[model samples]
Target: MNLKNNIETILGRPLTSDELNNINQFKNQFSIDEDDPLIVVLALVGANKILIEEMPKLLQQKANETIDLHRQTLITQSALIAKDLIHVVASSIDSSKSPIQRATPYLISFFLGGLSLAIALVLVR
Candidate 1:
């Protein structure tokens, strides 16, 4: 059919091998074995009409901005869950006694120093 050449001309580019093959495959809307040129042209015309009419609606449906609220809700929920998990993890970590308490003699020395200084100050007063 001259439709192939016409499409190429409208596109201002030569049809590639893959494009030509696809056009041939989809040339017959129902059966590829059918050789009725008029049927093929009519089918192509009908398909083009459908695309022209439905593409905008389909595209808008897919890219609609109305889902922003749902997306924002999901993000807010996930962030809240993450914040809760962080608090739980931090509390659990802080509750555990570490070996550093025994490993570091500085803690005991600092405590004794503070007590001695307090006692000295009280005795002086």
Candidate 2:
């Protein structure tokens, strides 16, 4: 996705040769792995004063939103992992195995349950 081309298309006009050259140079200089390329391009354009100064604010908002989404996802995943751990613990405890086998499973499940609790606590924060 070429940023300049997208901008030009949005404006419904072809950019001048100088603008194209600048955009090309900027693209080479600005290297980042971003989900949304428009944000980075907008920041660069803002730096050159070719776009509004509010670009950074938009970028900040997007970053905050992304962070929030990831946080929620992590918490949800933690809960799921905890649920699975509990299930494993329950099944192991219910098994009709020898006393020694049951003892080991109980000990393992106790530690795993503790780990799951830690993950849940961390995700909550």
TM-scores for all candidates: the values are 0.31, 0.43
lDDT of 1 by residue, 1-125 (tens): 46566556555667668666666666655554444566446445644654576589988887765565556555555555555544544444432457675334444544554555555445433
Off by over 4 Å in 2: 1-50, 95-125
Worst 10 residues of 1 by lDDT: 86-95
Off by over 4 Å in 1: 1-36, 65-73, 76-78, 85-125
Over the stretch 1-125, how does candidate 2's per-residue lDDT look in tens digits?
A: 55665657655667678767766676567653334566456545534554454479989999999988888887778767877776777685746877887787767866787787677668667
lDDT of 2 at 36: 58
* Per-residue error (Å), model 1, residue 90: 6.7
* Candidates' C-alpha lDDT: 0.55, 0.67
